[model samples]
Target: MRLFSQLIALSRSRQLGRQFKEIERCIKALPRQARARLGIQTLREIGQASRMEFPHLYGTAPEARYLPWGQGTEIGYARALSDNPEVALRGIALWLAVAYHETKDCTHAALQAQHRQLLRVVRELKESHRGGDPVQEWMNTGAAA
Candidate 1:
């Protein structure tokens, strides 16, 4: 009975992992800017999903509260600035390739370099995004709408 119970639990956990992979696949199907949007959305959804799965994970312990913000706030804010279209598109391409390589178990230094380059471009674009919103300007003037 103990072995059966453990096997059942393991199988359920595996199924949950597969479900998470499916969610990731859905995000990868979108374009770069779209991926960022969906990435945010998926993260929010996962929070809700986790609460539904294990309510104990929620709520804080008064004894020792760990704020996730810490020193990562500055880094996170910098990354957030790169949420525009051109850089976002490039980021998405890099992300897709990375995800593919990861899923296929074929990670390489060049792939990491490509991803880092996209991140750098996104950071640069974000710094200049306020100067002129070319993506928005072109979209506003384009026919794709």
Candidate 2:
């Protein structure tokens, strides 16, 4: 029984290791700016931010009230984009995934609030991106005006 249990634990560990590797690969695949937007500087930061943002989802706390996801989230994202694009992109991806999942049903009041906040953040980011590069904006609009 002991041997059987040890083998099962080893197999589970291997599976978890593979999953972590895949996640790292996916993070690396993202563009530098995108990664920065995601705020992917360090694993510690990600763990802390995620833990605070979604305590319930992460099984950290019973009451899962997120901090105000407004200007602060946007500022962090923008700063990450300028300072460390890679980290930002990873953080952005994680945030988007969580927001998308939480808002999909649009049933819970808290989730709905967060979904709305996420939309605002996205709009602001889009505007900043467009404003920063006129050439890119022109191309996006299809041909120079």
Candidate 3:
């Protein structure tokens, strides 16, 4: 099993009292292997509403970019969510290789570093999303019509 060093998120929210809890919950629900692949040795997020800071996780879309805390590591959220996750050169390459169906069974997977693309396209489709569907989608779609 491989893992990155520890990461901690400390926040002060205007309402809930535990801001990064959503992100924490989502990450915590991962399988041991998934969590290990995520690479953070420890994910400690204390918050109230939703702001957060995560290491190694990159966001590749507008929907992925909403977490309002940048304790330092912010490459790009639109890359992938953990369920769909991101890893910059490494992650994007890995995500493409592991992409959707196989993300759960990454045991003994090997990736050569040169596979990253100059242009990456991420389509944020909703497949039985855990949280309620983002109302923004409705508004955006409706507004576009």
Which candidate leads in TM-score?
2
**What TM-score does prediction 3 earn?**
0.24
> Once model 2 is optimally superposed onto the true structure by TM-score, how far is the C-alpha of residue 110 displaced, in angstroms?
1.6
- Order of all candidates by lDDT, from best down to worst? 2, 1, 3
Candidate 2 versus the native: TM-score? 0.33
**Candidate 2 residue lDDT tens string, 1-145:** 8677556545533433343344445545666465444433333333444556452233223443453222333333343344464455544444444433335454444445555654554454444443546677677785654
User: What is the C-alpha lDDT profile of model 3 across 1-145, one tens digit per residue?
Assistant: 1242111111112111232233334445655455444432111111111132332222234455544432222222223333454333233232322222112222322211111111111111112222244686666665758
Write the residue-wise lDDT of candidate 1 on 1-145 in tens digits.
8677556545533433443344344434555556455445324433442444222222223332344212221222232336464443433333332222222221334434444543443343344333446677668765747
Name the candidate that leads on lDDT. 2
Evaluation by TM-score, superior candidate among 1 and 2: 2
Query: What value does the lDDT take at residue 19 in candidate 1?
Result: 37
Runs of candidate 3 with Cα error greater than 4 angstroms are: 1-11, 15-18, 39-83, 87-145
List runs of model 1 lying over 4 Å from the truth: 46-145
Comparing 1 and 3 by lDDT, which wins? Answer: 1
